[model samples]
Target: MSTAAANEADAGGHELRDLVTGLGRAFGGALVFSLPMLMTMEMWELGFAMERWRLLLLLASSLPMLMFLSHYSGFEATWGWKDDLRDVAIAYGIALLSSTILLFVLGVIGPGMRAPELVGKIVIHAIPAALGALLGRSQFGQSDEEEEEEREQSYGSELGIMAAGSLYLGLNVAPTEEMILIAFRMTDWQSLALIALSLLLMHGFVFASEFKGSEATPDTPWWSAFLRFTTVGYAIALAISCYVLWTFGRFDGLSFSTALGVLVVLGFPAAIGAAAARLIL
Candidate 1:
């Protein structure tokens, strides 16, 4: 081969190696994120028993969500939209494979299991597992520049991150009856207090109650940041909570006031997730 051809071959080989490494990382991430659900009897039952339409819809929605996650933080650093699409595909594939291996080892699957049953089980669990793969690099990778950039992120960028984080974390809790139950017990005054608490906690973690590496950027006025980041972050969290509740059929029989209370209840954790997103994501 000519020297140029040999160099081309070398570059291709390096790219192949990187891709393999990235997939390996994604597999590990999928394990960490999916293990809990894989082991949970409730999750397994949901996988097997969930309505066909809901399951299919959830599976279909995961691709776009994964693509969005890949845009912000993925196992591989993407160069373009095509690259992000590719990474999202690979992340889901890794999720399927990792979930299968773990479930099989856990005795959740046996040789005699039917094809549709096996597929449903793996596919359902892989949703969050794949997302975990998409977010794994950001949580695990060590880069001072990335951390510094996150610390000093613009208000708009922080709002975007908060939205993503709120949605991501809210999904985990939204399907449960506990949100509605908690809402049922709380009075109107209590709901109002919860909202106020969510905003204050978001403010403290993101701007005040200083922890190392959690300080604000210079020239960021206190009240402006409070209004923009804290208030907006809580709003995003509350919105995500309501949307997830609706998507999961949790709002099917609820009255408006009851639904508002549920939103407030779930918004608490969603807000915390949003506040910690900058540090974590």
Candidate 2:
């Protein structure tokens, strides 16, 4: 074959392989995010008991979130809005199909179920599953070639990535009663210690430690970097925790100190997630 023809064939093969790999990643990510919720009795109950308008609102909001995720860190290396849209479609499609298959196997949905009932269950589950699909690549996709490009990122961009990571990780565990339980068990001193530990770990992961893929601006002093990233990232994490708590209606009748404690507990994971985002993405 001519050189150009060979190059074209190789390119086509790469594209096909990428598509296949993306599909697999999407499914894997969907399962990771969905399986826990699928197994939870509360999730199943919520599916049935949730108001129709609320369900519709969740569905509507999920699309934009999916798009934003795809644009930032998709299963596919998307270049533009068109590619983002395509990935969002693919992610949602995979989430819907995978949720249906798993839920059916689990007997959450079956041949005997009414259409609306079945759709509601699947849709409720698909929101998180689809988010997983979008995040799968960022969390699990490995590529040394992609990692080598050390692009200089702005503060705003870094903050955005950190916020995304915070939200993703925090959202996973925030809806459960355990978050509140864990909070209620902790005293004021413990909460302060936890906050200190979270900041220390976040700094270690992103700025101070020698972990693989850790970021360092050689010109910037370590203490300054530590101060900035630790403070900003923790703030973002706290904000995400509050939003999640509010979203799940976990804030009802809570005292100020208790709510603050809950936010700190959840913020631990969120801060680590933010640090991971800086290192990885």
State the lDDT at 259 in candidate 2.
86
Among residues 3 or more apart in sequence or in different chains, the pairs in candidate 2 whose N, CA or C atoms overlap within 3 Å are: none
User: What is the lDDT of every predicted structure here?
Assistant: 0.76, 0.78
Q: Top lDDT: which candidate number? A: 2
Q: What TM-score would each prediction reach against the true structure?
A: 0.80, 0.81
For residue 64, give model 1's deviation from the true position in Å: 3.4
Q: Write the per-residue lDDT of candidate 2 for residues 1-281, one digit (tens) a residue.
A: 99999999999998898778778888998998778888776667667766677678657856766776787667876667898998888888999999999998998888977777888888888888888898787667657654443334567667777887786677677767888999999988999999999988988776443433334465667787776777888999898778766665677799988888889999999899888877766
Clashing pairs in 1: none
For model 1, residues 88-189, the per-residue Cα lDDT tens digits are 888888888888988899999889988777888888788878988888777667346444433334556556667767866786677566788899999999
